[model samples]
Every structure is written in structure tokens, then in C-alpha cells.
Target: MSYITGFLTPVKTENKERYIESARKSWPLFQGYGATAQIENWGVDVPDGKVTSFPMAVKLEDGEAVVFSWLVWPDKKTADDAWARMQEDPAMANMDMPFDGKRMMWGGFETIFQN
Candidate 1:
């Protein structure tokens, strides 16, 4: 089964273009480091929950939008290695993340089943 890294973040609505551009420039670095696939989605109809929600999870602010993303790797080892390498890669080091890193949430998952 493949390894996956999922991400959730709140990005300023006005910075959506900048966020997309940043992703475009960074995706290749991940691909070069053995990532098989990556997906980034901007929230369209996300609703707030009575007690908890995506917006609450990221401490979303006015003028900000939720972004959901994921990356696929052959396995955990490859994903781990790639992430470590990404930290040292100049392209990634120099790239700017358009969202608030402090509020970003991420995790790694082992795929147990897939159709």
C-alpha cells in the first residue's frame, strides 16, 4: 500500500492565486523526490460545524479559505526520505508558502484499503 501525507490549512482568500503558484512551483520538488502523486483542493462549500469543523481546526480567519491536500508515495520509507531531503533542497527551502504555517495541520497515513 502507498503512504500518504494529508494537509489542511487556512489561506487568505485573496492569496489563493499565490497559494496555487507556490504549489505549482513546489510539486516538482516532491515529484523529483519520489512522490507519485499530489492533489490540492480549495474549499468550495465547506460549512462550519456546531462544535468543530475544518475552519475551526485551522483557526480560520475572515478572508481565509480552507485547503485540503495530499501526496502519495510508494511507501512510508520513501515518503520519510523524501521529506527529509525536501528540507535540504534549495528549491524547496527558497519557496514561500502562501498560507499561515502556524495554523497548518498535517499527518501521514498508511493506506489500509483502497478500491
Candidate 2:
């Protein structure tokens, strides 16, 4: 089983490009530390349900788009270590976070199925 850390957030319309650029800049930092990250832009027709139905979780005052992202690690321990390093890295310091942490929702999910 692979350890996974999930980050789901609604990007501010005005800051979308800036946010993505910031994320792109930070991508290598994560890869260098032994983790893989994948970012997904939600579809307009995303259904409202247990996972996709996070209407209340969105932060934008008046927006319908959401960005769902996840980072995959070799295992939980490695993921934990990478995140710890990321916190201390100067490159990650003072970087503008793409999404508002307050408005975002995230969690670590155990891998149940993968093909």
C-alpha cells in the first residue's frame, strides 16, 4: 500500500495563475525529497457527493471552480519526513500558498484501491 496525503482546495479566481505558478516552482522541492505530487483541476460537471460534494468546503465567496490535489509517497514514513523537510527548506519559506489554508480541506487517506 502507498501512503497518500490529499489536499483539496478552491482556488481564488483572480489568483489561479499565480497560485499554479507558485506550485510549479515548489514541485521539484517535493520530488527531490522522495515524493510525487499530482494536481487536478476539477471539472465543471463534478458531481455533488461524499467526495466531490464539498460545496461547504469551498472558500471563494462566489466561484464554482475547485482544484483537487494529492501527493503520493513511497510510504507514510517517507511522506512524513518529506513534509518535515519541506517545512524547513528556505525555498519553501515565504512562498505564497496557492489556496487559502483556512478555506481548504485536506487529509491523509489510506490507499484502498489502485490499478
Candidate 3:
């Protein structure tokens, strides 16, 4: 079974290119540390909710778009190890984020069903 790290981030609409480039730049870092793949999806038709929604969770603002991303790992141990090692990676430290990190939310998920 594979492990996954899911992420939700609100990036400024204008920074979409920068965001994609940032992800492209970081792919090697994650792959080097055991991530099998990285996927970043830019929201196309995300809707606002009255009570709670993707926008609400991230306190999305005008001129911003939501990014749904994930990293696929072989398993939990590999994922955990990669996370621990990434913190000390100099390249990661130097990587500039295109969005507000404080609003980003992430979690590790155990795949329940996959074909």
C-alpha cells in the first residue's frame, strides 16, 4: 500500500506561474528523499460555501486560487523519514514559497481504496 501526504493551499492568482515553477523546483527534493510522485492541481471552478468550504478553510481572498496537491510515498515510514530529513535540507530552506505558508494545511493519509 502507498502513503499520501495531502495539501491544500491558497495561492494568489497572479502567482500561479510562480507556484507551478516552485513545485517544479521542489520535485527533485522530494523525489530524492523517497517521494514517488508529486501532483499539484489548480482549482478551476471552486465554489464558496455558506458554512465551510475549501475557500473558507484557507480564508481565501480575492485574486487567489486554491491548490490541491499531494505527494505519493511507498509507505508511512518513507513519508515520515522524508519529512524529517527535508527540514534540514538546505535547498528546501532556500526554496521560496509563492504563497502564505500560514494558511496552508496538510495531512498524511492512509489510502483506503485504490485501483
Error of 2 at 42 (Å): 3.7
Ranking of all predicted structures according to lDDT, beginning with the best and ending with the worst:
3, 1, 2
Per the 3 Å backbone cut-off, how many clashing residue pairs does candidate 2 have?
Answer: 1
Candidate 3 CA-lDDT value: 0.95
lDDT of 1 by residue, 74-100 (tens): 999999999898888888878989999
Clashes of each: 0, 1, 0
Give lDDT: candidate 2, residue 47: 53
TM-score of each: 0.96, 0.82, 0.98
By TM-score, the best candidate is: 3
lDDT top scorer: 3
lDDT per residue (tens digit) for residues 1-115 in model 2: 7888887787767777887787787778888998766565653665556654655566445654577778888888888888888888888887878676777887878788999
Q: After superposition, how far is residue 56 of candidate 1 from its true place, in Å?
A: 0.4
Q: Per-residue lDDT for 49-74 in model 3, tens only?
A: 99899999889999999999999999
The model with the greater TM-score, 2 or 3, is: 3
